[model samples]
Target: MNHKPLRARRAPEVARAHILAAAETLLAQGGVDAVQMRAVARLAGITDAGVAHHFVDRHGLLTALIAYGGDKLRAMIDATVTDWLESEPDIGVLLAKLAGLYRQGYSGLAVALHAAGWRETGSPVLEKVVEALHAARFTSGVSAPDILHTRLVVAAFHHALATDPLFGTEFRRSAGISGSRDDGAALQLAWWISVTKRALGYDE
Candidate 1:
């Protein structure tokens, strides 16, 4: 086990960063359930109540984490857009990266926020985070509807590939999901290309 330093081992600023950093790391490693206050505090070299002082409770800490994660996702999507525009790369490679990037961490963030948003629907901070996400995605080169379609495809693909028993979307599973992830990604790209051809009058 990686032992965390005791609370007396660090300065105040360093200690705070440790807490946030530990929480963020745990969240990335194991999703929402990993974000225990005591665990974060221990990792940060602080008492559990010290963590609570920075955040009201588990919900408050989760809220802050969600905000941080949203910012990261927005940055990722923006970078992906720029990369796509610049290289105009093969759709298969792009789709594969898309599935992998969002699957590992971003979806966990989204799931956390969705639960928080449900509990405290009127929260201004949560509202802004979601609104910003929607605005960022919709305002990108892709139209709102197609962007949504893309998200649905990626999420469905990731969940199924992970053998996540709950997600019922069939667009991914219908491919019968065999061999390499590259192969699955190629299939997704084929689907996207068909959609594009249909939409753009490339196919008569």
Candidate 2:
């Protein structure tokens, strides 16, 4: 089969995206250190210097990486919003969905980014996600209980996020699952399911 030659485009956005996408994958696999400039360039299919030319130094690149992660988290949350709107997910079901999301969505990255930069991207995205969900509870309000309505369910959720860290709590005791690498990702998915379901009143 004759393969068409790959066409190159010099669009700055495209190039920037290449770099960011490369950084994102690296962060997902091995956190920040995995996203060195040279590695990012190589992953982006560009010259090492090309990566530097795009961003002045590793700090700039790191900032971009953080930003990219935030963007990814926001998108993931948005997708979760759509999913929750699809069915009637109660608080428990919502917690399960959120737990699953933290396992896969950008929670780790978002947490890392928060450590680096206090400016909110995904949280606001999550809050907006929560806001949009208010219709589900028969009103558009995001309150503490409205989020879970019961601390027990929230306990199930935090267990998923913290991987059920030892806290001398009975829920923690019963909710224990042999911690897994994908635990956080799973929690994120479940969090979104809860957010949207609660917002739309499907949980009611």
Candidate 3:
């Protein structure tokens, strides 16, 4: 919805970005199954062949989208960290914002890509994205061990986002947690954030 209609010619990089954006919208709306090349082209205001030129096939487009989403995630994290530094927001509040952002912006798309990465046995772009994520998480004053622990906590948060929707009830039933799945997940996330802040000696 935010892109221009394709002209006779456009910058290749710009065109690819628009196509990927369309793909992401469709993916979020209808899951991976909904992201056909023709659908993406129609949404991006390009020809199916035009999209195919940029991405070889469905899997290729999905992979490229994974990388594109990684870049966006990094940008969002950078912005969040900047705001956190300036406002010195409470850790609970900050973590909640981050959780909401991840859940809404990245979780569904990431779930599909993560599955693809596993099926493929590895993905270079995915690995780099993950490494960049870990590097971005380092707090200035936190020790290595503390940073590692914080990463673990953050990983748990991400894992919950990826799995909770599908497995939440089963997980809670097995664990004997007495609450709605959403409520239980919220509590768990808050606890992890608290532990992460404590480990990092974050004053909030």
Candidate 4:
């Protein structure tokens, strides 16, 4: 006797979540190019038509993935800011967390999306970080210049970490730093952490 395999039914949201999770895994493994629809469908345990039913096409899926990443980043920033407001702030730890997210291939995906003409109107994630830093530095008065400076600092750090996966090691080597790729990355992260801390007036 032959047995048929069972297919568990999922809610639409659940199915979309599974598809996005599968896409993220592919992105982490081999950047944006690896997140093909059929591969996503196979990894998601769904049919190609099922994947298409949700995403419509690769571009739609990728757009949703970018939005998904933004949501994740926003949540991370919220938690980090809560910790910062409630206790001693550790800028290094915060910066390291930001770097870790970029290292997970989201950075490359972001760049690719931008080159493909996908532009974000604004970043709530950046705004939250800037607000937290401003509140930490000033208790009473509002300084536009200070806020602007904080914004610039955060933007610079974001750009650096986003590009680090692509150019960090070579950039470090050009500056005469020598060792394995991991070593260069570590050194670069440490330097950025320090600079960010100092710029934010968190360093002693």
Which candidate leads in lDDT?
A: 4
RMSD of 4: 3.0
Clashing pairs in 3: none
lDDT of candidate 2? 0.60
lDDT of 4 by residue, 1-204 (tens): 998998878999999999998987887677778889999999988899999999999999998887775566567667766766676565676678778877766677667655545555566566777887777566433344367888888998988988888888888889888898877887888888889877877644
Candidate 1 Cα misplacement greater than 4 A, ranges = 1-18, 89-97, 118-186, 189-204
List TM-score per model, in order: 0.54, 0.63, 0.67, 0.81
In angstroms, the error of model 4 at 178 is 0.9
Q: Between candidates 3 and 4, which one is better according to TM-score?
A: 4
Clashes of each: 0, 36, 0, 0
lDDT, candidates in the order shown: 0.56, 0.60, 0.68, 0.78
RMSD of 2: 7.0
lDDT of 1 by residue, 68-176 (tens): 6666665675566556546743444444445555456555555654555523233332233233333444444435544444444444444543332123234356656
Task: Give the best candidate by TM-score.
Answer: 4
Per-model C-alpha RMSD: 7.9, 7.0, 6.5, 3.0
Report the lDDT of model 2 for residue 148: 41
lDDT of 4: 0.78
In candidate 4, stretches whose alpha carbon ends up further than 4 angstroms from where it belongs are 1-5, 121-123, 139-145
Per-residue C-alpha lDDT of model 2 across residues 1-204, encoded as one tens digit per residue: 999999776788888888888887777666667778888888888888888888878899988877777777667667766777677544455445554566463555555566667365435555544543444454434443455443333344444553322232334335663444345344545554565455344444
lDDT of 3: 0.68
